[model samples]
Target: MIRMMTAAALAATFPLAAAAQVAPTATVAEGTLLDVVAEGRVNRVPDIAVIRAGVVSQGATAAEALSANARQMASVLTALKGAGIADRDIQTATISLSPQYRYAENQPPVITGYQASNSVSVKFRDIARSGTILDTLVKQGANQIDGPSLTIDAVDSAMDEARVDAVKRARERAALYARALGMRVDRILMVSEGSDGGAPGPVPQMMVRAEAKDSTQIAPGEQQVSANVRVRFLLK
Candidate 1:
């Protein structure tokens, strides 16, 4: 009989499995999900300046090219030291020696000469004198200059301030939503945090010639730091 088979199947199952199916579920009116976005901004003053600059030289032989590059890099390092840069703050970024080539329509490329390059990274504490230091580098033999990325030396306090702003904004938004629905905020259910590291703006490329008369004029403008937060609260 159908009833007999059903009873037999039930008897074969474990007691825990049968109990799990009959367990009581929480009883409450289902609530709707409301997503809110809150943004906080903080204006930070930069404390350190990082710059990349280098020397380029050409010679008939690889050794000669490297020797020339070394001499020019030495002079550049000396200029940085004179400008109050410490050895720990200055580092050689790259060094390379390669043969230059001349190409023809039907003939194989011919080695015309050898070129050597040595690049260095410099960090400066005094940002106001950055332009003058760049001028000094060019005068001493730096042919390529990459960037002067401005950044804050420490971010703990700034980040904390930003977090406070974000939380305040989130609370304001939640209150507005609750009031619209004819209710008051009861308790915060959850909070989620997000962050972004600000990227530096564009830097233009320039070729400095030894015969140039004026120092390179640089303008380091203000940078923006942004934060976002999400908060969930119960409605009373």
Candidate 2:
């Protein structure tokens, strides 16, 4: 969203905080200025994929459940490594062991069994084969799967492009306003930028059969990087 900070009069209808910081006053003979808040957006295709894959096991005893979970989780990790996933790109996300209980109508709940779960978060630099890798992890005893948040690894360049666009747009807006008022843009008084944008969060996963007929399909759409800037220009 973009906004125009014209004068104290413009602030009469806007929030006090925003109005208070409206176009700053400058000591000049003309005493005319325009402040514009502009946003710049740049879109780039995502180059990486992140996912969470895990194993859950159950047994009559805690030791049994833990051992079973460990064995299955080991296979899952090995599968990721076999698919060229580096150790640095993989990290443990969760690990838990809890006793299962049976609810009885007439008495206290009884302990039935134990459950063990272990999960890992993984980053795939190769988005093309992410789906196939996901399926392979499932076959390797990963029963719980989540995410595939697509993102760009290095965002500085994209952000820089966006910032440039914002400044350009702000200048254009100021010029338009000056033309309408029969005045000309004289000089830039200030240029300030806002904070960075948010990254995509984790997405839910649908359960698929471990034994699939073919390699899974993955589609990584474009991601957007945005920047915001506030500019104050002197008008003559």
Candidate 3:
């Protein structure tokens, strides 16, 4: 019985001794490794614009609603072509026909009418006239206007700017860390990139009623395009 008790005590103390032996190695490995992060941001002016414009018509029948919507949208397309929008720049985005419902206190929901809507995506090369174009569209018959989401069509330049900024930031960090630890930075052990996720500028909304004879007011304020990047550097 005494021998068995001694064996049990030895078994319990073995793990404690092993844990004490392994603790120092883990601490040393963690101390020698360092992780660094650097961020870069750049702002540029937007050069391209995208607009979503469409027509909405409602009538007693689905065919009538769809016909009315088609007629008005055709006129809108003609006006856009006259203003220099290329064929490739215009695309039909949506066409939806839904029944209009009316409810009464004592009766089941009745189909009162039907509505048809069609939307188009328009890209503008000349941003100066974007507002004027909106005004023209409303004057013609466009009832639904969604956006003028601004963008920088050529993103390569913006990406280049971000890359340069990232390099500068990484170098600045490496110098700071080297100074602090009294060690010199040798070379970049690894370089990995994090995308900025295609930065979009801004989208402003403009509203116009069909009853208005003249074009709606347009205001295209300055839009800011931005880019971001993260870089990691190693030290010796």
The number of the candidate with the highest TM-score is: 2
> For candidate 1, what is the lDDT?
0.71
Model 1 misplaced regions, further than 4 Å: 1-35, 202-207
Per-residue lDDT, model 1, residue 206, is 49
List model 3 lDDT by residue over 142-231, tens digit each: 888887777766677776776667668777777777778786655443344544535554456666666766655444545433333333
The candidate 2 region of ten consecutive residues with least summed lDDT is 11-20
How do the predictions measure up, each by TM-score?
Answer: 0.79, 0.86, 0.75
Off by over 4 Å in 2: 1-27, 198-205
Better-scoring candidate (TM-score), 2 or 3: 2
Compared to the true structure, candidate 1 yields what TM-score? 0.79
List lDDT for all candidates, in order: 0.71, 0.80, 0.65
- Which consecutive 10 residues in model 1 have the weakest lDDT in total? 1-10
List model 1 lDDT by residue over 1-236, tens digit each: 00112111232322221111222133213443344557777777676778899999999999899999999999999999998889999988998889999999999999999999999899877777877898899989999888777777766666667777877988888788778878776655445665545545445344567778877655566665666666545555
For candidate 3, what is the TM-score? 0.75
**Root-mean-square deviation of each candidate, in angstroms?**
11.4, 4.2, 12.2
Candidate 1 vs candidate 2, TM-score winner: 2
